[model samples]
Each structure stands twice: as structure tokens, then as C-alpha cells.
Target: MTDAPALFLGQSDQPETLLLSRANRHGVVAGATGTGKTVTLQIMAQGFSEAGVPVFCADVKGDLSGICMPGSPNEKLLARAQEMGLALTPKAAPTVFWDLYGQKGHPIHTTVSEVGPVLLARMLNLNEVQEGVLSVVFHVADKEGLLLLDLDDLRSMLAYVGENAERIGREVGNVAPTSIAAIQRSILQLEQQGGAAFFGEPALRLEDMLRTSLDGRGQVNVLDATRLMNSPRLYAAFLLWLLSELFEQLPEVGDPDRPRLVFFFDEAHLLFTDAPDALREKVEQVVRLIRSKGVGVYFVTQNPADIPDSVLAQLGNRIQHALRAYTPSEQKGLKAASQSFRPNPAFDTAEAIQGLGVGEALVSTLDEKGAPRVVGRTKIRPPDSRLGPATDAERAQIMAASPVRGLYDTPVDRESAEEVLAARRGEADQAAADAKLAEARARADAAAAKEAEKAAAAREKEQVRLDREAERARAPARRSNRQTPVEALTKSVLRTAGSTLTRELLRGVLGGLKRR
Candidate 1:
């Protein structure tokens, strides 16, 4: 096998033997902060890009933007590449930038309704009841044709349904009020943490993510997520959603010579914080199964323990950076990271990590013919791409030139949960108003009936009085100067069995005109 220009974290003595063609196999990169983790990630992405395989990686510190431009020729960079026997090519790989915020890169968006309940429940850390209620929200959204675009839509729908829980719950099987409230609370928390910004229409397309430039160079897609690292929960939820989407959307291509795209998940530990056992198992399952689809997942973290052992096992190519063993736990972590690799006989693998300099790491990758290359104290090569972030102008230019630039730029509302729940609220308000109107009508009818009875009794009493008066005075005393309108109304209401306020209220409700 020929020694092709290497694009990886560390140098290799065997050069061509390690093929890493097993699309079934993946890789991992472990290193402490500032220990050149980003640079190492860049190397792998560059390597895969050169291999004509597009790479997907998160730009946690905003540095992966450098892939958009070729790296400058520095004295140190040239020396290192020369030392590694790599004829330095002053050329950058084709690349694209993506962001959930739509700020630094093209917007990568997805709808909450599409995410569904199972994954979302895991996201919110919802209990069984809360999960069930969440499902109800999804069901309602689907039945009503409401798209759960963003967090607000789902949050509003949850509240709207909760307001009419007694009625809607009864109709929709068993939607517990308690669970709805709990899910609502979780939604609020997610909103406050900025999860609302992720969902909407014109969602990210997996096909777009897997595309290359017209020049046939795989586009290295970089995500700008500097602010997201602060919100661990949101970060984890978003990452999991991305992976699940890839699995669900991408076709089963079986094993190709190389992965169509590779995903480098930085800050991998956040992915498991408070995750339920079942969801964690599901993640492991996705990681294991996605390889057959020709997608490689590389997790970058500070320690091996950050990854679940089940997930740790699926990583085939391993790149370990230097770790500080000042504390007992740190020392233990170093040993574990070292033991994870199939040892290279040339160097003491355990000590190599502490002794490794910045821009250097211990690499173990598949050989050219697709075998595990002999581990060596390999010198890492400088990236042919920029060592740092692309300039603002560069990002803007690339974004403008991006095929997906205008695709997700404008957010779409699409008659989703927000619209559905808004309509439902309008219905409820109308229903309440109608009920009030009916009640008023009933009172007016009753008042008219009572008025009829009172008028008859008064007429009868007058006849009796007149008859007696006629007997005494040979003529009935004529009743003149009839009672005033106010007095007449009071006298009529007093003859009824109802209270005065009720009669007055009824009169007001009937607008002083009882139906005859």
C-alpha cells in the first residue's frame, strides 16, 4: 500500500496498512481542554474529506470554521508536516457551516412534532406519567394537524389542553392532568434554557448534510454552538435528536468502502446527563447500528469514562491526547484511556499520553488494506486547512454560496401546534360566552312567566276590593295616578318567589324586556 498524504490526529510508521474501510467500525478522540482536541478533530475531518467522505462535526469553540479555507504555511506547520513525511499541500478542504441558532452558519432545524414523544420525553427527563401526557400532546397535534414547530407551540398546546383537561382527557383515553402539568413544567424549563429555537419548518435535510462540493470534495459541515455548551441539557437533547434523525432518515446503504459522512460529537459527556436507562440503551443501539449505513460516529471528550462502556466499545479508530494525572481519578482515567487501545509495541502506550506535546497524540487507526495498523509514537501532521476559525467574511461568503443557504433561512410556521391550540382556545372562549348567553335567556323566560302570574293576581285582588268598596259607597273608588315605572317594576318583582337581586339581575340580563 502507498503512503498517501495522511489526514489524521497522529503520525503513522506503517503508513498504508491501516485501511479503516470497515464502515461498521467507528472512532473516538479523548483529550483535555486546550490539549489540541479541536485540532485533532480537524485532522480526522480533513482525512475523511480527502478520502471523498464528507464529515459532520460540532464546532463547540467556534474553531472548526477553519475548514472553509486552506491552512497558511507557518514555519512550525511546514516543519511538522515535513517531519511526518507529508508533502504539505497548501490547500483547504471543502466545507460548510451549520448552526441550530442560524447565526454563524446555515440553520439546521427540526420540528418538535417530528421529533415525537419518545425522544422528547427522554429530553425533558419526564417520568412515565409525564411521558404519557407528552404523547397525548403529540397525538392531539397530529389529530388536529398542528405542527409542533418550536418549544412555544408545544408549550402553548400543553397549556391549552391542560385548561380543558377534564373534557379532552376524558375523550382521549387517559391523559392524566398531573402528567400534563408535569410535562408542561418541563416544557417551560426547556424554553427557559433556549430549546425553543431548535424546532420549526424547512427542517434540516439529511441528504443535504451528506452532500459534497461541485469539485467532488466532501463538504466538511461545521456547527457553531459556542453558546450551547453552557446549556448542557439543551445540548444533549439537540445532539441526540440529530443522531436519531440521521438514523431514521438515511437509507440503508450497507457497508461502503468508506462512510458517506462521519459525525464528531464534541462534549460527548453532556449526551448522557440524567438520560433514562432505556434512552441510553437506545443511543447505544443507534451508534452500533448506524455504522452499517456507512456513517461513523466519533465522540470527543476529556475521559473515556465520559462515554458509556457499551458505546465505548463501538469506536474502532482511537486517537488519545495527553491527560493530566494530578488527581487519583485523573490518573485512573489515564490508565483506562491507555488500556482501551490495542497496544503499540514501539512505545510505552501509558506514558506516551503524559509525554505527548501539544499538536501530538497517540493514534490507532485501521490500515490501508483495512487492518488495525501497528500503534506507534506517531507525529501528528498540521492541517492543510486553517488552524483556526474562518473569518466573518469567509463565513458569510460561504453561507451565501451554500446550496442550502436560503433553504432553512426563513422559518416556517405551517399550521402546527400553535395554530391548533389557538383555534381551540378561540373555541373554548366562544363556548363560555354561549353558555352565559343561554343562562341569560333562561332567566328571561322565567321572569316573563312570573310576571304573567303576578299581573293576574293583582287584577283579581282589584276586583275584590272594588266589589267591597261598591257595597260600602255604592261605587268603587277609582284608582288613579298609576305607580311610576320604577315602583311598578319593584312591586311586580316583590310578588315573585325569587330574590330581588335575582329578579334585578334577570331584568338586566333580559334588558328589562322579559319575553311575553
Candidate 2:
């Protein structure tokens, strides 16, 4: 047996300890509603923190916030710790509270692009066709280099895509108006459900959740999810996004001495409930591969069957509290839960699961060789932290001392898709107006030119008429019987001929005829 750094889960046939080295392999905590699941999660979270591993978990019932305060164990808890040979030191994990609504703790924010279309569609409860249209919209935004930072940005982009559907459809795919409208309605519904606060600038930084205290203890990032539970999809989507962010950003670390971070997904059924196949496949993929990044994901749910078998198979450590098998479905759940653990000749695993008490559980963890250890019935360890939710004043003090105090408190509204699209619309309107004005000016100029041409023609015609009348008035008057030029010339010729003839008669008639 290796004496590596480990968490002493509880006292069992032997000590039930989870080797820190194999903690990255992932785990699960399953039980009924009041079967000590929350307490188990609390202990595991504080254990990871004390071991210098940062932890992130949702405070579903608001009670998990008590992890930020030191414990004051009663007689029963003290007796349990004493029985386990553990020194119950009253100390709290260094905790930072986070909230999606920015009410109970520091606000958590992420952009629309960060969430992506698949998860965003899931958040909006969109149908397949609507989801496809949303993907197209996101593709257009990305191709255009538009930032979808907030809900308003997404709304504007949706409207823009809808208006230019035919044009954008040719480039990407068909963006049906009905699908767009459906998605728009879904977004509006999401906004009404208080999901709008989660999408904006100053988004969550992974480093903030991965911080270690000045004293070398890991910070427990407690996400207050009391109200978030109302919007179950939003809560699930946000956590999934955070996990994805870690998976993408963190470098591969293989198996280290311990996990760099431990993430607890409480009310985990919400993650898989009504999840589409593509999204379910993605969740399984992330859960399967994220261990190599030195992160451990532990799911806390009411039943083991709440998790898919593919994902369930990846969990190396399992702490199962009591469960009820009244109905066939629940009986099946019980059977499945029991079958997950290696058989214990000491007792039937299924009956053991049902018989477990509030603080008692069946603990099974990976052995030194990375094999499943033989199941053991264990008495769970008492948390060194407080057992319930923190007071408002305590949460306030914690928030004030948080490392990321003012970083994401104020919402940022820089120029994004919304503003850019608005500007585009404004410019388009102005261009249309300018074109109309130009057309009007052209028509008016044509009318003016036609009128000027008609006026010039009228002036020219009047001038010709006046010139003709003046010429007539200025002319000298002639007798009505005045002979023409041809007539006068003929008369002169005749007179000359007559005179010549008279002269010729008197002298020579031949000379007069020659002169004529």
C-alpha cells in the first residue's frame, strides 16, 4: 500500500482512503435527497482544498457556502472524528463565492461565442431546426468577425441574419425565418429566466478559479446556485462551459501527484436531462478526456442511473450513500448502483446501498495499481468546515476579500455585434435616403431644363415675327399698277425697236431691225 498524499474518506473494514495520485481519474457521490450527499460533497471539497487542490462546486441548496466558515462540531461529529483517529481541526477552506445573477456572490459572465451554438441552443431549449439556424447565425458572426458578447449582441445578430437570410443562406446554409423567430423567442424566454446576466464581457477567468491562497491552500470556488437552480439549463450550461474552458486552456499534465483542480457537479442529473445526443456525447467526451489535464470531476446526484453508463464508467472513486428502491425504476437504479462496485463477499452490495445510514456509505476507490478496490462499508468523516450556508455578512466579507473582486462586477458594453449591426442599419438607411434625394434632384433638374428650352423656343419665334413686321413697316409704298422688272425691260426694248424702225423707214429698215 502506498502512503502517498491522500484523503482519508472514512473508517471502514480498513481505512477508506482515496489516493491523491489517482484522484484525477474522476468520481461520483450518489444517494437519496437526505442521505448525506451534501455532507459527503462538503468533506471532499474541503479535503481537496486542504491538499492544495483548488475546488469548484455549485451551492445548489445554498448550504455549501458554509464551507467558507470554520466548523464547530457537535458531540456526534467529534465522536466520529475521534473514532477515525483524525484530528478535527476547526478550519475553513479559502472560498470565493460566485453567482450567475450577481446577487449572492460575484457575478459569473461568459460571451455568447464562448458558450457556442450547441450549448446556447440547449440553454434556449431550441429544436433541431432552430439549433441549426442558430449555428448558421454564429457562423456568420464568426465569418464577419463580429463579437457576440451579450444577449443583445446575439439578438441583433439574429435579426440581422433573419433580414438577410436569403443572402447569408447562400454562403452558409438555409436560415429559415421561422427558425430564426423561434430562436428569438427562446432567447427572450431565457432572458426572462435571468439567464441574460450570464452573457457579457469581463467573462470568467480560469485562473481566478485555480487560485491558491497565500498560505498555500487551494481556494474553494463556491458557485451560489440557489436561484440558478430555477433556470436549470442555464446552470448546467454554465458549468459545462467552465469545464470546457478548462479543458481547452489547460495544458496536458498527464497524471500528477494530485489533481490541479477538483470540480463537483451537484444536482448532476440536470446536465443530462433532456440533453441532445450531440451534447451528451460532448459531455461524455470531456469527462473522459479531462483527467489527463489533471482535473477531477465528481458528480453528485440522487442515483447512479442518473448518469450515462459511458460517463459512469470513467469514475474511479465512488461514494454511495443510502437509496430507496420502492418502484421498478428506482429498483433498477439500485441494482445498477450496486453493480458498479466490485463485489464484497462480506455483504450484498445492493442491500448495502439501501441500508446505508445518513453518515454511512459504501466507499470504493482506485487501488495503487489503478484498479478498483474491493468495496467497503464506511463511516464518513465529519467536515472541518461549517455544516450549513454562510451568513449574509460572512459572504459579504468573503466577496470583499476575493481575488477577482472588481474584475467582473461591472458589465462591459464595448462595440460588439449589436452596435456594429445597428451602425450598419443606420448607414443603409442613410444611403437609401441619399439615393432618394439624388433621384428627386435629377427629376427637378430635368423639369427645369425642359421649361428653359421651351422658353427659348418661344423667344426665338417672337423675334422672327417682330423682324418680319418691322421690315414690312419700313418698306416704301408702290403703285398698285406698277409694272414688273421683266415688263418694264420688254417695254423699253419695244420703244427702242419702234424708234429704230421709224428711223430705218426714213433711212434704212435693215439698221432698225439689227438694233432691236
Candidate 3:
């Protein structure tokens, strides 16, 4: 039992270690502020890395950045090492820094489709109706083969759904415009809080977080959450999304010798704060089921009560720091925390919980057989890495040396729902414009035809008038040239007499010529 390979957490009677094989059962580290919870986290992170198990943790206060740099020996660290009867060596874990905003580390992003509607509804603080509307939006996107890659895509989808609420609602569900508007306002609020940067491409690949360095040490991915902490909902939703992604992407390995990845969720209270019962249940379910995928989820928070009981029950390893019991509620919380631990007959667990000093915690971890050991009042080990924030220069150097340097630094805005809907809207607008133009042209043609017909009618009337005038002038000439019946008879008689006289002259001339 003593020779079993384990993560040396702290020393009670001897070295109290967490069995590496049982690490995927999940754990919790709870303490009030300045109770060395971060250091405990750092030590565990170091152990996991040294064991070649990759770790992902949020750098909530920027302190975890020091894991990138080697630690400096100090009197306090040396005293703790000597007290724990171990030689503490200063070493740094291979670390890769990440930031949601891309300012502090490599930008970590996930597409809207990746985040999905459930977490998004929680992120936007949507009510049931709004949640339903958001779900419908996602459904419509899927049905139309629209890729929702970024915030703009989501915005466009929401607008599209709003514009076609009746039609889409009939297909998906009943989508209320008010619900859509509320979701829209919620998205805008999230954007203002810097949540918009987290949705886009190229999205973070889960394999990147599981990478180990060339030296075989696990890569410690430290997400810079300094700015993200302001939007607690976004922070929670992002972490949940990551967990969901891991659960979905990683194949089940059963009980492996070590976890595929170990996740440290700091400020874990945000995950459950005002979370709906259904979401809480889903989270509890993920925590329970994800272990089968060989992933370990450790929740770091101030109070044990912050975690839902269902989730808290799944955590096998517990390192609880001191809790102050000045007020009644605090006393009640202290009682709850103290009662949660498996009692060690060596000391009063409740008294020990109150009296534990900084760097000391009540440690309990799963045995090699996958059962919780009796809780022990233990002095936690100091981190081999530096205990404070890294300098800007060091962070820059680490980021520059990252294997994924150019991978996610630049964002990609691929053709998504936003562009597609915009094109559709443009086409629709152009069609409307064309139709209007056609209608106007038809009206203009009709008016011109009407004017032409009037002109033609006027011209026909003028031609008729000229023909009548010509006929009238001819009629007067005909009347003036007209003769009486007697005149007509005299003319006829003269024409007959002329004919007879010509004939007689011709006959006389012929007779005279013949006689000569």
C-alpha cells in the first residue's frame, strides 16, 4: 500500500496521497479566501502534470499563471517541506495559457452550435418561454443547414426567428416575439460584458487541452479569467460547455490508470447559482457520467453548500480548508462542512475544521480500492511552481512558445447563419424592389397607352373633318358646274351636227379630185 504510485497531497501521520488510479472519481477543494486553496490546486495540478495527466484550470485571480515558471525556494516552503519529511524540488509544469478574450493567452472559442441551446439559455438567464424560443432558433438553424458560428450568427438567427415567428414556430414550437426580444437583449448584455468574443472560429479543439510536452509532462492549460469573471454567467456557461464537449468527444475508457484530462473549476459556485433544477440535474449527471470517459472534474470553491448535494456526493476526494463561524449562517455552514467528512478517531473533526491554519486542510482521498479514506487533519504540501501571478514578460514568452501559437490567435468568420440570412434578406429586398419597379413600369405603360389612344382618337377626328371639308368643297364645284336639261340637249345636238358636216366635206373633196 505504501509503495503504490499516488499523488502526494499532504502528510497526516505520513504522506497522505491520492491514488492516481482513482483520481478520475472526481474531487473538491473548498476553503474561504486566503486559506491556501489555490496552492492546494497548484500542488494537485503539478502532481497530475508530473504523472503525465493533462490539466485544465481557470486562472481566476491570475495566480495560476505562475505554474508556467519554476518556483523559488523560500523559508516558508522549506519549512513545510522539512515538516512534511520530504525534499521539495522547485519545478515548473509545462503550461499553455488561454484567454477567452485572446488578450492574455491563446483565444479559446466555441461556436454557437457547440455551446448549444441549453447552456446558452442558462447563460442568457432566459426564462422558460425565452428558453423555448432559443431552442426553436437552434432548431430552425439546424433544419435550414445554417451554421451558427459566432454571436452575429446567433443574432441573425434570433432575428430570423422573430421575423418568421409564426412560420418557424409552427414548425418548431410556439415562439413569442417578446421571448425573442428578451433573448436578444440578453445576448446584447452578454456582448457588452465581453462574452461575445467566446463564440467564433477557429474553435478550441479538446485535444489541444489534452496535450503533453516533449518531456512527457502534462500541459497545464490556464485560462485567463480575469476579465471573464465579471460575467459570471458566461464563465459558468463556458466551463459547462467545455465539460459537455469533453463528455461528448472523449470515448469511454472505463477505469483507466489515469484520467485523460483533469479539469479544475474555480469559482464553482457560479455554476449552480440560480441554476434551474433541470440544469442542475444535468450537471450532476454529467459529473457522474464523465468519469467513465476518464476525465476528472475538481470543483474549487469557498463553501461546500455552493455545490448541489447530488454533485457534491459524487466527489470522492475532499480537501476542505478553514471556515469562519462568526455568524449564525456561517456556523450552520461550518457544521454542514464538518459533518460531510469521514471522521478520523484521532481528533475532533469539527474542532479541527475551525482550528485548521493556512496551508492546512482536512484531506481525504480514495484508496486504491476506490473507497474514501478516513478524513485526516493534514498539512498540505506547497506547490513546486511559483505561488503568485507570472510577470507579463513570462506570460508572453510562454504564449509565444506554445505549440498552438498560430492555431487560435486569429478568428475566422466563416459563412454562417448571419451571412446566409443577410443574403436571403438582400435577395428578398431585391425581389421586392424588382416587383415594385415592374408595377411602376406597368402603370407607366398603361398611362402611355391611354395617352396614345386619346391622340389617335383626336387624329381620327381631324382626318374625318378634313375629308368632310374636301367633300363639301367638291360638292360646291359639282353644283356650280351643273347645267340645265335644255343646255344639255343643245350641246348634244351641236356634237351630232359637227360629225355630219365633216363627213359631207370629205365626200365633196373626193368627187372633185376623181374628175380632174
- The candidate scoring highest on lDDT is 2
Instruction: Give per-model CA RMSD.
Output: 19.4, 5.9, 9.7
Quick one: ranking by lDDT, best first?
2, 3, 1
All candidates: TM-score: 0.81, 0.90, 0.91
Q: Which ten residues in a row have the lowest lDDT in candidate 2?
A: 504-513
Taking the tens digit of each residue's C-alpha lDDT, what string does model 2 give over 1-516? 578899988999889999999999999999998989999899999999989999999999988999999999999999989998989999989999999899998898999999999999889999999998899888899999999999999999999999998899888888888898898899999999999999997988899899999988899999999999999999898889999999999999999999999999999999999999998999999998999999999999999899999999999999999999999999999999999999999999999998998999999999888999999999999999999889999999999988999999998889999999999999999999999999999999999999999999999999999999999999999779988999999999999999988886876667777899
Clashes of each: 15, 1, 0
What is each predicted model's overall lDDT from 0 to 1? Answer: 0.79, 0.93, 0.91
102, model 2: CA deviation in Å? 1.0
Residue-by-residue lDDT tens digits, candidate 3, 176-205: 878878988999998998888999999998
Models sorted by TM-score, best on top = 3, 2, 1
Worst 10 residues of 1 by lDDT: 14-23
Per-residue C-alpha lDDT of model 1 across residues 1-516, encoded as one tens digit per residue = 445434445455744223436534777788888888888888778877877788888888888888888878799888877776777786787777887777888877788876778788876878877887888778877776677788878888788678778777787776767777788788778777666677777888888888887777787888888977877766777777788888887889887766778888999988876777877898899999888777888899988778888999888777788888899988988998888877877788889988877876777777655566556666667777888888899989888888776888898777766776778779988999999999999899899989989999999999999999878897667988879999999977786746766878877878756653
